[model samples]
Target: MEQASEMGEIGREARHEGGKDEEFRVQPKWRKFLAHVGPGALVAIGFLDPSNLETDMQAGADYKYQLLWVILVGMVFALLIQTLAANLGVKTGKHLAELCREEYPRFVNICLWIIAELAVISDDIPEVLGTAFAFNILLKIPVWAGVILTVFSTLLLLGVQRFGARKLEFIIAAFMFTMAACFFGELSYLRPSAGEVVKGMFVPRLQGKGAAANAIALFGAIITPYNLFLHSALVLSRKTPRSVKSIRAACRYFLIECSLAFVVAFLINVAVVVVAGSICNAGNLSPDDANTCSDLTLQSTPLLLRNVLGRSSSVVYAVALLASGQSTTISCTFAGQVIMQGFLDMRMKNWVRNLITRVIAIAPSLIVSVVSGPSGAGKLIIFSSMVLSFELPFALIPLLKFCNSSKKVGPLKESIYTVVIAWMLSFALIVVNTYFLVWTYVDWLVHNHLPKYANALVSIVVFALMAAYLVFVVYLTFRRDAVATYVPVSERAQAQAEDGTGAQAVAAAAAADHPAPFRKDLADASM
Candidate 1:
């Protein structure tokens, strides 16, 4: 009777503490939504990075409205893949990179890590160059000087993150809002045909000379690989409950937040394309304006807008570009940290990691900016996007394989319908990227003036690399899940089992030999 009374007192104490916690928590719809807002916004910034801007501008200026459908399709694929990534982190208490470490052999793990790191650098190049472009336009600084400045600026932003992820997220969200306003305002001012925009979004077409190539660029820009790793890791920052019901609720909330973020990103992309298309297709362009449209690079994009929206509009463009570049650079740095820590089991200070990545990314931008100038830097962005395209399958195939396996994710494994659709999307991306590679190579081979022997040697090496890439992808797709039979134990149960005497302790010791789900608090606190 005494023991029962003590238990009742303990239970009442718990209820009282919970009640106090509830009182302090955010109430109603908007406050709760804001709490779940950070990770999705970070992921969404990848979609609006400078790489996307250059490609979107090119698409609009060159093909008018023929490739909007690719953006729509790519974003839908992004939503599906990002949702899986978030769920993986939430359920396993491990990010994608950590999971890869545990699931693959050391050698394979190293290869995956190298590939992921390359993807991070590939994603960073455009951001670094884009920020330099912004500084050049806004401050009248040289692009090379701007490149040097971006390294320090990104370091400063990483310092801001020491305060809290939420603070940095708020700043990024503000940048996104600023970009949206600038592009949408431009879209409203120079009203493109609503019907044509709608048709471009729904009706699929790739008829123009470079239309197919731009369509591939659009896919690369929207559906990035490191974004999957970054999203999975970012979800660990939120304090989610461990109960199945609570987990489901958190997943739903994340999905809703991600959907909203993607919607905003999609609208921003559409606005960019529309603004470029409307200005270039106006039929009343001056010679200089027409020439600007003919070579519609990022440097000339703002000038094109100035011709239509006045010189003041250039400031708006520069500010928006600056915001895009800075926000995405912050995200890329965070992703680099996550990838390095998760893959190698080595952790470093954020500033140190950011500095290393920034330096590596800046070298190429600085050289290209100084040597080849702004035009070369713009081409570098396009080339970086293509590199991302080539690297996508390496990251994606592993993600899909793990997410579908029962052992790795247990009951959290994706549904058959989801798995089927995801693989189909993966297949489509692979096909498109492969086609782009082959077509570009074949066209080069046909047009180049190189000697026959030299061309043959080059072709042989290119084909060999392609063959190796395909073989690696196939291996990732079919490799067995290393932890396919592992089961997770709750912390409370694990503690109790370990504390018990004799046989219980023996069983718990044996269970400990197997891989265990990471501690939720530890994972949440680390980020």
Candidate 2:
């Protein structure tokens, strides 16, 4: 009886203490619907980035829109996956990353931290560059200064979350409008063959050098790793009633919202491809368009829009780019916090988290920009995705285990069909990524000028390391996890109310040291 009272106090304190907030609240019925639509907008913005643009551009210019079907297929997968993210948050009252921290082994958690952190930084570079380039195009601010300006402005805005999450969502919403307007403007002006556009959307084909890579880029952009973390966490920002039915409704609404948003996003992605294909595939083409076709950057996007569309296209395009960058930056910051808190249960200031990411992202970016200009920076984004591809196994394998288990999410969560599809998708992703890694390694070995002996030795070492990594990933896939043994809602309420007394100690100790700083984020297979 005494222990039960102590548990009750602990629950109450956890609920009340710290800056930790209850889920977000919508004012009226209409507001809930409106708010339901928010995350997908931000999510779409993440994929509409310059890097993703380049992929769409390359795919279209080289393959002439044959690979456009990837957008539709990819979004289908994305909708399913993102809904799972939202459901996790709603069902567990915890973010995916936090759940990961709780469920995964220490070494695995540490590795996940490093990889996830890297993915954020890599994702941020394009955001920084895209925004910086936009400022230069629209306002004549130099790229470097513009980057600093972007980091500063975003940080300032983040500082004002005191106002509320809804307000931040509003700003991001405006940015979404801007992105939509810019793409539509470009689309209208280019006036590409509509029949062909539809055909492209439905068709699947690839040809020529690096076409496969471009397709992967499109997929990677659309179904980004960090966006999963962000989406799952963002749902928590909503104040859904702590009832199963209410949470289920909220989940369903979010699914619809994300679907609509992703469709719009899919359209924008198609618009970008069509615009680039139109501009670059110009038979009487200008030198600039042809050359830029091979490699489209943020600066090139606006110019292409202007030439293809009307004069206002550049302004519209730049505005969209700015929105893309800012939205991504905000989302990245959120995910970073999720990672920190989820794994370690640490809660640093938002500025601190953002700063850490910006510093890590900018340092390598600055070095590359100074040494090799934009291309070097661009390569960093690609390599970062590659790293994300490597790190995906850790996050995904564990997430799959959790949702599939009766313990963590309970049996009522995902359906059997959903589980099967997720695994199928996961398998395809791993194969594609792993295959590419091997191909790149072999190609590197063939091209490098090192002595045969040295080359052989290096190749062996690289092969061994990759083998180990793959083994670990495969191991996670085949293993079973002890689920969280989730409690019923009534029991949950009881637990929370009985769990308050040690709140400070719990929160503070969890804050002191990251529980899995250098670990691999691997879950315990048995439990």
Candidate 3:
């Protein structure tokens, strides 16, 4: 009777295991896709930030559809780089910054961290300004006051974490969809030439003044550096499966989700350019409207929209701007947390981290808004975007190196075709951005009517910085991958032994290393 009871228990356990496997296999495709949605949407926010909006507006108003091809190119590159970032996290169980910490020398890692932090701050400046601008429009508050308000508002957004990361992602996704609807509605109203839009996307051309600068700005604004960090880290939040088939499925789902998100972003951007180009370039524009188009600032963009979508459209524009700023700021906050913790191996409460980032970002924004007023704040947004343009190579080069390294990723390293294409894209971006950097500085030196001695001194300093920048890029490009190449056979044997013993020893060692429950809690909560 005892033996029969044991046989019955074993049969039930086998049926349960089979059912679990069957359930996994038969899970609906849509549900799987939905599970992988948040990270892509979060990363997509960077592509639609206020900086990108400003550049898109300027591109359309200035060159009509001539620079649309740049947007296409930028999105394609963004998709490629972001996929690599996602793959790195899923395969290695480590984010990019952590890998950098493990791989690079101490000093080099420190420098990289500083650069990454700078990129974060630089990215934040535009969001701060945009949020402030939204407040200036919506509440009749001064830009300086709005800048102060942004700090608190961001904290409130970060507060959504108590609910869950998915809550925050959902809120941001709603904002993105809202923005897209507004732009698409405006696009339908204005009826920009579909032919011109198509030509602009496919046929590469850069005509007229400021086209090159605007193109570089578009590239920078679209394919952000910090978003790479954010994407790799964000994927860690999802509980992806460990089996090879399951990993591949998760990757494909993520790629589809990211592609879809970026496609939405790409279209919204195109719509912005289209709406601006069509409305501002109309034959019936008033003299004031024409002048506004000639010098399109964020403040003037709504006024231009008012001409087509009626006066009420400005409020809609402001609402969308608010959404853009708030959503992107939240994503930036997460990126900041990931970057600090990964690079430093130190953790902080999310609120504390957000406050620190906001304070640093707010100081300059507050000063600029107060000193120069709204117009000055607008110019600051453009300047901040330019800073992002220059910082791209610093981040991109390292990402390409890590993703392509067979030793680092082992069997999961990218294919040769992917490696070659990625490097080519990286090289092209470096060359174009470098050229833009050199030419813009030279152009300023030539055009500025400063005293020769003072001008010469400034020029010397600028060129020296440029030289240093090139040297650093070269260093990153050729840097050795120092991450552990192989685990010794003995170590593997010992690990297998520990696993055979049920991993109690491994768990104890981990507990010893991370003794504080609060620290582990903080890290887990943040992830």
**Candidate maximizing TM-score:** 1
Candidate 2: worst 10 consecutive residues by lDDT?
Answer: 518-527
lDDT of 3 by residue, 376-484 (tens): 7777787787788788887788788888777666556678898798889888878887898788888898899999999989989988988989999999999888766
Model 2 Cα displacement at 246 (Å)?
3.2
**Model 1 misplaced regions, further than 4 Å:** 1-34, 160-172, 304-309, 485-527
Question: What local lDDT does model 2 show for residue 180?
Answer: 62
Cα lDDT of model 2 by residue, 1-527, tens digit: 99888766655544443112122232465666775666666676676776676567667767776788877777787887877877776676667787777666888778777777777787787777777777877898656666667767678767776567666657666765676666677678778887887887887776676766766767767776777777776776565554344566678888888878787777778887787777777788778667776666667666556644467767777777777676677778877877777777777777888888887777766676667665555555555544655566666666666776777766447888998898898888888878877888888888989999999899899989889888888777776664464655443342332343333443333332211111222111000
lDDT of 1 at 14: 39
Question: Which regions of candidate 3 fall more than 4 Å away from where they truly are?
Answer: 1-28, 160-172, 307-309, 485-527
Q: What ranking of all candidate models by TM-score puts the best one first?
A: 1, 3, 2
Greater TM-score among 1 and 3 belongs to: 1
- What does candidate 1 score on TM? 0.86
Tell me how far the alpha carbon of residue 81 in candidate 2 is from the true structure, in angstroms, after superposition: 0.8
